[model samples]
Target chain A: MATVVAVIASTHHPFYYRASTATGEDRPPFADEWVRKILTFRETLTRADPDVLVMVGSDHFHQLWLDNMPQFLIGKAPFYDANWYNEEREFGLPRMLLRGQEDLSGHLLREGLDAGFDLAFSNELRIDHSITCPIITLRPEADLPIVPIYTNIFAPPLPQPKRFVQLGRTIRELVESWPSDLRVAIVGTGHLSLELGGPRQFGPHGPDPEFDRRAVEWIANGDLDGCLAEVTLDSLHAPGNATHGFMDFMLMMGVAGAGARADHVDTLDLFHTMEAYFTWYPNGAPTA
Target chain B: MSRYLLNKFLYTVDRDAELVERYRDDPRGTVAWWEAERANAVLNCHTGEASTWLRFTDAEREALANHDHVALFSLGAHPFLTLTLFIAMFERDHAEPLGFQKQYAVRLAHFDLPYPDIAT
Candidate 1:
């Protein structure tokens, strides 16, 4: 039987990848800083190596649509790989690190559905950066196998803040019920406060400490709804700032069963973009 | 490494860029521009003072270039940013310039033009 060893929620800003890829004239001067934060987070994740990573994040258009999009989609490939192909038609992946744990993916999908979520399963789907960038960052060599769980935060008619919590609870049940002894880590990626492509975007820069603090406070206090409500597109000052990335937290909280203790790593208000990170453990015990 | 300016590129007509044009229209070039810049696309319609940034992986760029309508709903940006980014990517002979803003107190933020894809 597999038990989740850890749950992590992080902020996502693809700009980090762009910064890494930029050249002299096109690159920003702060590329080093961005790269540093990314590297630091990667080191943290690597230090806490678990058997399986249940990646919970927003699915951007690669799967799901107004016509066919489901509220939740679970990746069930046996040997899934991350990394989008670059110009040379070569995958810019650090390595083909993440293998697919179809068994866990299938188990979680069923438990999620039984828990009242409209969960969808995909055997042929490929994992994207929402799952990729962070995975590569954490398991730099791409050795860890993954079971990706996507939320419909990108499209409207998304799961309610309350519903997402419920989904998390169901996930906990699924993890606890696994037949084989497995180690798991859940990761959530999105944003904390930085909004994308709206008036709020150009208005401010860096993680809104006030906003980020409020969110962290809510989570530290187990105010799940408060945390969820704080990260939505409408409530967030900027549209893109919807803490779609933070959904991973809710999932982790669910797995932790409302009593897990969390350790805050770094709260960065990078470049007007909010990227806060935290790690949580079940039963307040250290992960093996 | 070969770099392609989005505005100067051409793409297959039936791809995502053309499909995107069905929803948004602008004075810039056509869908090919966006298709070319799909991996790192930016949108600059409002003014020099403000713009939205978008970054897509090659597959994401291809899905958009191929005009996969479903891609629109799953991405992070709102519809306007998504549409504008798509439009600019397809527009011919159009490219947004690069510049920096004091995004954070200690760091300077960089963005690509037409709407530069903000990196770092």
Candidate 2:
């Protein structure tokens, strides 16, 4: 059976990459501190030596649109290309040949389907910033294989938060059943509060640190039910429609298993958005 | 108002490169072909060729053309598509002509939105 080694959840806003080169006036004071914390998180992943990294993030109309939005989609390819944009280039993001684990991806698709989830499967999906920003910041070396799971967080009628939690449980079951002696790491990347293009798009609205604190506290204590109870569409959407990134966070919590507890937790509020980093071991211990 | 027309317009343009090229080639024709009444009005307002039959206020027309993101948002344009359209129309070449963050910062300022020192 595959051994679940580590689970990490962190924020992946594009600005995390852009802040370094920005002028002193444009750079936030917390930017350097955030980078240091991110590097530390990366070192933890490297120490875990996960063979396959399952990345859960949402698209931003870059790959999927309303015409063909799927509730959940998994990438099934041996190699995937990161969608290159001028903004990413300006940030000096290097061209990366993202590696994929086809065998594990196929198994996940089969398991997900049999378990009553109609997950969309794609072999040629291009990834957006949600996945890239995390990888670039946390794993720039690109040493391990990754499987991209695209959840429909941006589109309306999103799958219930509980469903994502259940999906994570299902993923855990599949990993446990795998015959290979593999180390797996799941990375959930997104933001805490972000409102884009709405009435508050140009206002003084920003990240709600109190909300983020409560949500993270629940996750750290293994209160999946509590996390879901508080972090609802109404609560997340209260900040901004773009705050749907919480869906990915819920998935990571679910994959950590119901009883799994956080051994380490770190967070930063970048004024407009909040970032949270967590490391979990299966038995609620510092080491699995 | 049902944002169906606006959603459809943005969805199609973002997903279909051919249609985006078509839109660039003939904005009015593309709008007419889409046959979405409100999308047509929105695009037409931007092109300075308002439909004779469509009735839109001068403020609405200016909002559409100037890529006033908040106005588009109020009209129920998807936030992702709103940013996509802004990039496609104004920042296509990635030239930070209006300054890197200013493009979005200025628009956010218009609506008294918080301007974060970050890129989209």
Candidate 3:
């Protein structure tokens, strides 16, 4: 059986690549601190030393559209072309190509369907920053093969928060059940009190810092019951219109298992949103 | 209440560099042309198989034509789409980083929670 190496979740801020790479007068003052925090966060994953990654993220209206949208979709291909033209125009993210683990993709889709997710499969997917931002931050080498799972947090009438948790639990179960000896890490990214394209956007801090405060504690402590008790489809809008992305965090918490505290947790407060990072080792923390 | 068509306009135009420039330079003209030529065209389907009933409401059309992002938000168009396309069109005009974004927020400051329903 496959070993679940690490269960991780964090905010996928699109600006990190540009901010960290900027030099001279163009660089933002927050860039250095942000990079410092991210490097430490990066080490948490480095110690796990997983051979494959199951990447969980939502497409920001890049590929999936309302004409025919899926609540949960997984990419099953040999390769994925990532980043869109608008992302380049706005966030200065470089284009990237990632190798796919087709064997794992097939296993997840088959097992995920039997587990009742009605999972959508994309043979050809052009992933956006939700998946790429973490790759840029966590795995700059981008060497390990990945299975990209995209959820519909961006579009309306989304799946409920609890459903995300359920899916995450199922993913953890299936990964462990896989008939392989390879070590796999589950990595997902979400948001903390975000308000995109709204009245509260571009603020000095996340639209609702109090919500962010409570949210970090919930994830670090793995308080799934506390989070689900407070978070609902309608209730998410109060923090920020886009705070629904936090469901991905709930999904990660589910992967980490209920009441299982994180091995590492860190946060950086950015202008529009608060960046968060968390990692859990199911078996035990790597000694190295 | 064709919020889907409103989003379609933003999505299709935002992805295409040519359309972004055209929409920025000539909003009214670009909106009119898009309605006639591209509104019914399914993104991944054949042009001949285009849906005939995907046209935007008069208010939606006006919002896009005038580049009125605040109106778009109130009309149930996805705020992310409205914001991204608008940023592409106008962010270059600002001198400081995030200047255009902050200004964008101020434009819609009148809105409160339970903002418009964005369900397609």
Best by TM-score: 3
Question: Could you give the interface RMSD of candidate 2 in angstroms?
Answer: 8.1
Candidate 3 lDDT tens digits, A117-145: 99999999999999999999999999999
Give stretches of model 3 more than 4 Å off: none
Considering every candidate listed, which one attains the maximal lDDT? 3
lDDT of 2 by residue, A224-248 (tens): 8788777766566766657777877
Instruction: List residue ranges in candidate 1 displaced over 4 A.
Output: A18-27, A81-97, A202-209, A225-248, A257-259, A283-288, B1-120
Taken over the whole model, the C-alpha lDDT of each candidate is 0.55, 0.69, 0.94
Across A1-288, the per-residue lDDT of candidate 1 in tens digits comes to: 776766777765555566677798978777777678777666556656678888877655444434366777888898765543321121233434468888898888777677777778888665666777676556656667788888776555566656677777777678878897777777777665554433234344544557667766665556665566555534543334444445555665665556444664666555566566667666344543
In candidate 2, which residue pairs get closer than 3 Å at backbone N, Cα or C atoms, i.e. clash?
A: A202-B108, A202-B112, A202-B113, A203-B112, A203-B113, A203-B114
Interface RMSD of 1: 12.7
Q: Per-residue alpha-carbon lDDT of model 3 for B26-78, expressed as tens digits? A: 99999999999989987877667787877878899998899888899999999
Of 1 and 2, the candidate ahead on lDDT is: 2
Q: DockQ winner among the candidates?
A: 3
Q: Give the TM-score ranking, best first.
A: 3, 2, 1
